[model samples]
Target: MNGSGKDDKQRNRVIAKNEAERQTTGDIRVSAWTIVFAIIVGAIAVYIVWAWLHR
Candidate 1:
């Protein structure tokens, strides 16, 4: 058999690995942003409730 088959498999494996790493890093950034927004919203909610109760 020609060696072309092994080379194709190796190329496919590398492509898949790179895609996986890209997706993982993308998810991490999204998760960080989500956490930041969640904290901000929670703080705003607490402020609103405190102001409502005191006023």
Candidate 2:
């Protein structure tokens, strides 16, 4: 409403560029316990499906 279409496009481009830069520089940190828990849950799910199919 306040600005023109070109201004909106430029603002959107700047926002997208910043987001891209942040993602590239970001570090993903996952804890060991989280990984272990996920694996345990996945194994349980697989076991349940296997038991269901066999029985």
Candidate 3:
């Protein structure tokens, strides 16, 4: 019984660790995309303003 309980605890810890890692990876991916999108938007805005002023 004790051995079985210990195994369950270990399994639960492993599952929790895996879940945390997955979440962190997802967060990093989302952050990277957000930064890329922000850059594209900023570039577009700058181009529009420059074109308007020059014209």
* Per-residue accuracy of model 1 over 1-55 as CA lDDT, tens digit each: 5799999999999999999999999999999999999999999999999999999
Off by over 4 Å in 2: 1-30
The list of candidate 1 runs beyond 4 A from truth reads none
Query: What would the TM-score be for candidate 1 when compared with the true structure?
Result: 0.93
User: By the lDDT metric, which is better: model 1 or model 2?
Assistant: 1
lDDT of each: 0.98, 0.84, 0.99
Q: After superposition, how far is residue 12 of candidate 1 from its true place, in Å?
A: 0.5
Better of 1 and 3 by lDDT: 3
Ranking by TM-score: 1, 3, 2
- Arrange candidates, best lDDT first: 3, 1, 2
User: TM-scores, in order shown?
Assistant: 0.93, 0.45, 0.93
Candidate 3 Cα misplacement greater than 4 A, ranges: none
In candidate 3, the residue pairs with backbone N, CA or C atoms under 3 Å apart (3 or more residues apart, or in different chains) clash, namely none
